[model samples]
Target: MHISRQQTESAERGPRARTRKLMLETATRLMQSGVTPSVSEVAEAAEVSRATAYRYFPSQAALVHAVVDEALGPILDWKADVPDARARVGDLIKTAMPRIDEFEATFKAALKLSLDQWAQRQAGTLGSEPQFTRGHRVELLRDAIAPLTGTVPNDARERLVQALSLVFGIEVLVVLKDIWGLTSERAQSVAEWAAAALVDATIREAGNGA
Candidate 1:
């Protein structure tokens, strides 16, 4: 009886793994082309049965969320060696800017839904956790800054971090690319410049009269 059960579990595991792979591959291909492929289409493309696809991901949103999580693997691991504080911050911004642009459309769509969810929560209509939160992003930014600053004062560190947040926001990208009509490369250049300026401005502010 034990041997039979083990064989059955192993059989199920193989199919499950294959289904997961297919779903991910299909979704990524569709999203790369600026289309949100439906579950049936994904299953057809992947040559998996519809039932198998649904078993792996019950809904399109679930598949999309999984794809986003998988796609962010490298960006989520944003740690690199640099020679100095200025270079460290600049390198970090440069590393992140292009990654952010890749998922800009997807993020813009999802964030709109999230904003609506926040409004519902504020009106006492939501009965669940917050839908949109940047607290984690803010914390990560602080962690990245901590190692770069050699001897910045507490106030200066706080000021510099706030400036980093503002300069690194998606709004900056939108303004530079959309309003100003700059190319993506040019916009990123502006963002990097702004981030560098913040670092320099904070250092000067901290040094004045000291």
Candidate 2:
């Protein structure tokens, strides 16, 4: 009997997929307990060998990235079918802000990892750790502004995306709740207002050729 390529690939992927899922779930559980656990720690907790764990996550950063991605799965998959740019952006904010609040601790841990890696890199001590790249907000913002493709200049749309990012994630939570002493409800309201204002401003500027 001849084995097809699809069958071979699927067979190969089965164990790898299960292993990756196990590691991710183990890491998430550990992180939820209020500490950024190392890969070895997660492996130990998950009852998987260190060698197997390292194969899936080469570093703590890589492991945290996967956990954060899993935590953000819902927002990353959100979509708005409205035609108005402002409405689309508002829908995104409304959908995302609550999830961010719900997963505040996870996001904070991820942010800490990002900052720690940054500091290590600046000190030339970052060794072989994979950098925790952050671009989910960029993609989300782009989708939020997709309705303005023809109306707003590409450059202006880019600017709008950039501006909206500032008010989108945990940073907004920190700024509004921690620094400004706003309640969660108030902070979310402000973020939504700022997002809508930025969208309107970008459209106006684009029309004015600015």
Best by lDDT: 2
After best superposition, candidate 1 residue 45: deviation in angstroms? 10
Residue-wise C-alpha lDDT for candidate 1, range 1-210, written one tens digit per residue: 323323533565764666686678777777766566667888998888999898877766566666665555455566656545567677777777787678665544444445666788779986653344433246546655675466678777877788787767456667887689988789888888887888777777766834
Winner by TM-score: 2
lDDT of 2 by residue, 48-117 (tens): 9999999988889879977887787668778888888899989988888888887777788788888888
For all candidates in order, the CA lDDT equals: 0.67, 0.85
Residue 13 in model 1: shift from native, Å? 10
What is the TM-score of candidate 1? 0.67
